[model samples]
Target: MNSPTMHLPHDDHDCGWYGALPSPAPAKRLSGQQQADYAVIGAGFAGLAAARRLAEQKPGARIVLIDAQRVGYGASGRNSGFVIDLPHKMALEHPDPAHKQRLLGLNRAAIDQLQGLVQQHQIDCQWSHAGKYQGAVGPRGLAYLEHFERLMTELGEPFRSVEGDELANVIGTRHYSRAVYTPGCYLMQPAALVRGLADSLPKNVELLEQSPILGLKRDSKGQWLLQGSDGQVRTPSLLLGTSIFTQEFGYLRSRLLPVMTFASWTRPLSQAEMVAIGIQPDWGLTPADHAGTTVRMTQDNRLIIRNTYKHVPRYGKSVNEATREEIRAGHRKALLARYPQLAGVPFTHTWGGVYAISRNFTNFFGELETGVYATACDNGVGAAWGTISGALLADLAVGAESRHLQDIQAVTGMPSRNPPEPLLGLGVRTRIRMAAWNSRSEL
Candidate 1:
């Protein structure tokens, strides 16, 4: 019988954040035969955390973490860089106070753990506790923000309301009529952070990049035989943190939805341009309407505009040039609306990143089968959720127990099943279009 093979998508555009960083060291691809006590596929936040935790738990065990591309070249590194401490859009759907509290704790735990790693390794990812701004431009958005404020109050989370001149002074834009500022969110250079974590993994954990798993099978002893392009790994236990691609591994097929989002970054602004804008040096803003644009001013004075979502059931390996131009044009329009003073400025980089979201906004975290564990579909909050889920997954694999693990289970049980193919695509596209129309003013 032919061996079961997996096909992975190839990304077309380079992430602006990754492109801004210095060139990464050459990748160490998997070659020759290898045996590992544990194997992890995907080197994003979740996989990196899983491998690190497993290595910490089993000092003598060999843990191999593999990625199809470089460590900082995937969805984890392509995110908007917000380590959110509180639930945003999810809170609206799941108003259960207990569930929200548990989620908050889990997210905060992720932040604390990340802070320790950054400090210990001195990772220069511009780790900032500078908080986040949720802004609204239209009456619909204002109503949503008001609802969010109520939820925050019910949760006893402190937040400040800013409007008009106050909001403009802070974010350097008067486009938003009202905003809610919460100090719990942390902002950073996502690419830098992921690369730092990969580089500082434990001594026992082996990180293999550019080593896509091409095939899979079981050995005589029922161990996992993972075949790569140049080599293969046989291991007793396997952990999958491949997100939406977990389907390519023959699991989570219709249970996950791959939504592609696009982002564009401007080259670092000249000092004169910076002075002309007269905005805060560094801050991040997410729209009150979930579908609206996300804006950020980097510490280095570059501007980032992120928005647009499309349901790509087949998964987006590479965005075609036409689609790239369309998305960039949308971003350009948003930037001009918000920071018209910088219309002459051009975007240095534009890229698309795909993240998996479930129908019910829950994550898939559990043992898939005997000797195989998996975590996928982080529901758009991948940074914190992915990190925490990865660590907890490692604990489960090692037969260790903790309250955090239980918390993760209590909150995110499993991804609810999704509608099959054509229907799923049609539904998602319709909803996205409706949302875009509603948030047109915000965009």
Candidate 2:
């Protein structure tokens, strides 16, 4: 199942999410052909979550969920594990306000659902609801924080801006001059959660790993066809939860584009180290100003720092050291600039993953050709968005119509330019350059 294209360092994902056990691969190389009532592609969070919900709604639905790689691989396994209610993101095209509000509400609801699932499923993925801090580390960023604080207060949300000692206690950084702490966000171990969810699925729902979906088509009766390797599955309905992998599966490849985000996690820090480094806020998350680094402490005492890599993506799969250094340096600089006290802390692991960003920021959740559907493009914030997106998708598929899904459906139906591969490359480059200047264009 190995490929010449696999990156050596990328294997670090196995250590955290897939656990010590060798997780199942995708559908045994898709041998020959198969049949089902429902075929869900990509066994990560979106697909798995949708499959679980579907089984609950339609008992014995004959669902077959497939993944290109093993379960918990891709962004689900490689993320920084912070479940920020509102993650770092920007929109390519704005959807309706009502839809935006619904998405926001769904996002808030998912935070609670994720916590409940982790517990109900008995997943050992350390979960904490210590809340989150969205603030500024310098005057340049302070204005942004002030705007958020004002907006929250105007909305009648109980948020208070802090400075001086309060700011120091929250972030352990003397560099930050302002802050807005929101109580509700949580931190999670993404990989562990993925495995636990997959392991806890009901017997009726089949989970297949290493099943790279090579093609999507229809049979003589017009049912959905998910073909991969040597196996083919004909299902009455199919959900493409492949997210960033859409580019590899037929028309979907160009239908959605990929955006890369980077993360670095330090080796588990001791209590003393945690306190010394100002990560002592038991269940806290941090989102500094725009173009700023996001930091959060995991249940294991590891400080997980993540940030958007200024786009300007190069073609192909190569990860250049020069670009890596540049991106990593940007992250480290942002971190040190915020927490000057932790400048010397060593990062044991650094990684990146593709975020499937569609032109409209909204993904294709409704029926695509025939029974096939897709739920992806959380922009760059899929942790919470994935849960919300999947739940909404499940509702839509089940005929349980809601304003939330309707809003998103309308947005996707709007005219969209998929931007050919050549244009996508250029747009991303322009994004990165504008990103250097801290414009809102790259969000």
Candidate 3:
């Protein structure tokens, strides 16, 4: 087949968290011909982890890390910035008990990896171990939280339940009638963290940005050739932590679903507004209802509200103009519902990021071809999953063995196949709409 076309968003809507930070170092765009012992495509959390792990293992091996845009400009940077350790609702309900433990172990490992990097490098991305709140708005939401409490109890995890006046004191919003405070999630500025990860990569790894891979094929010399717009990379081994974009390469195409989640962050609150809202310091909260908004008060005092999921099907693509505006408008409404005191607080940034989810809610891992390996489809937990998966894929690439590697390899399988085109697309869109309606109160 000919080289596939790239459809990544041109705007990415202006991410507030990313925008407020200092500009990243100059990008090193790939040009001419380059060669490496290993090439890991996509420089998000996963790719960064994988590249770092490979560099550590191989010492002086030539490793090339490539991204179409700047290292953190994609979903990794655009996320709501929660490094969640607990299993999401779907993972909590996973049929296999062993699977649940394996998932939790991997997630915690990812968090540990990130924490260690931050401490060792003193990379200041406002990393906080303040945990998170899951707030419920009504009976359905309360029921969900109750189930969550039972799940945690079964797993022997500790959590604090708060409601009424206490919940309001914690989050500065009395909108939620009930909440479960889980202490394992860390909140940070995602863009800064990703940039730091790229900056701190081992000496053997070379980062190439603004270099979109058009195609990849095995050459006559038994090397994989990655054709990009301005250059090419040939490597003996490849790891694709490209997340949702893995579908474009004819890998995981049948089973992966590309969906975009939108977020908006208000400008830093004024002293008067802060006093009016009354939430002290910084905090983060996820919704008890699956479709509810994710809210965060930044270290800088800005409030970020993320809600609305849109199924766009194509990876690296942007939602349409109308859809983008609709999501942003919905964000405003969600914020107003919680903090009407902050009404008219102008949102400094609004953006959308794409994440891939498999039909069965499991991630794609392990080798796809003789020398090509992949890890993608993080479902909703991108930060932790991507990081750990990236590291594991690197180990897998070099024939390294560990319990982490074994746990990852044990779950290797293709994502369940999606129905043909329009049917699949329609189904995904319909499901999102239904979810939104069901979670309207939380939104």
Candidate 4:
């Protein structure tokens, strides 16, 4: 391990997100004064990647990485584990065909980088080499996926285009009218990977768990000292990979909306159950019928289903019982709607986690005061992107520039001040209402 930073407060007592994944080893508590060249906040994918890269780049550079709770306790460990190469708003309204072409090119490269990292790290989180369905449940969804696939292939990526009953054969569902298959992506055990990455660190690096920085100060020497109730750490540079928790960095309380994305897992479906569901290919499923609802199967055979636009305070009574029921019902509807035969499966476990929502509903990054940087607003895709962001942001912290630095910087002007309580409340209510209206479930 590298140098250890102080710990923040503990998160609620939910560890099920790890989903029987092997537990990462415990990190030591912060004690006394520690000095480092780099201090990374939040030990999820972003922080971990930063820590590892810093170790590789500046060997023997004192680095202290801190987590508010245990590492991966946040969105990183709780993700649905979809390794996507697509950008947030990858299909922006940009009119320039060349810009669109270039974006497609970058997406291809991003996917390659993501897959390679999984392989290079020897991460054992059930890597599936098969293609996934970007199928549409209706005409519009199908058209969107088809257009996306067309552009991808046009940009030199591989995709299999299909429609009608043929689409059902590829996905395990009759719900979709059309679909395109791409072999490059996968369905993974997300929390397992997060834990694995944390455990694989060399002894030279130190991970401090349960360390939350309560405040900060600037020394006369121009360095920043992050202070916690238990201890204080002095580092000249720092990285904020806290996701929506970036509010801790200041001015992000409104800019980054913390949307809850809840997931439910059924008892591992028996062979009969799986067959009844028409899930032949084991490829991860995305709604070709629509753009939202992300559903997939874990390697262990459990169905992992999630829907977005849910929220509650960081810890507020399990999103209320009514909301929980809706998510659960929605998943069952998804299962039955897709595989009409598998209509009544029962869920064994139900839980939810938060996703950061920037104004554009994608990832955005920029400075939060001098010397402190925030790399958050992960929209919904936080697995590989969070890891890559952490790596690139670490480079930025060390004064090394990245080709992506400009594109992301352009989006993260100043963190928007959060709207008023009433307006923010209205936004949340609107999202819930819109989701309920579209879903097959009774709102």
Per-candidate clashes come to 1, 16, 0, 22
User: By summed lDDT, which 10 consecutive residues of candidate 3 come out lowest?
Assistant: 1-10
Off by over 4 Å in 3: 1-6, 9-11, 315-318
Highest lDDT: give the candidate number.
1
Q: TM-score of every model?
A: 0.97, 0.84, 0.97, 0.85
Ranking by lDDT: 1, 3, 4, 2
* Model 4: ten consecutive residues of lowest lDDT: 1-10
The per-model lDDT (C-alpha) reads 0.88, 0.64, 0.87, 0.65
Candidate 1 clashing pairs, residues 3+ apart or interchain: 10-317
Runs in model 4 lying further than 4 Å from the true structure:
1-17, 88-92, 96-114, 146-158, 164-166, 275-277, 289-291, 313-318, 340-345, 402-418, 439-443
| Candidate 2 regions with alpha-carbon error over 4 angstroms | 1-32, 86-97, 251-255, 281-288, 308-316, 335-344, 402-415, 439-443
Q: What's model 1's lDDT at 313?
A: 60
* Distance from true location, Cα of 254 in model 3, Å: 1.6
lDDT of 3 at 232: 92
> Stretches of candidate 1 above 4 Å error?
1-5, 92-95
RMSD of each: 1.6, 4.5, 1.4, 4.4
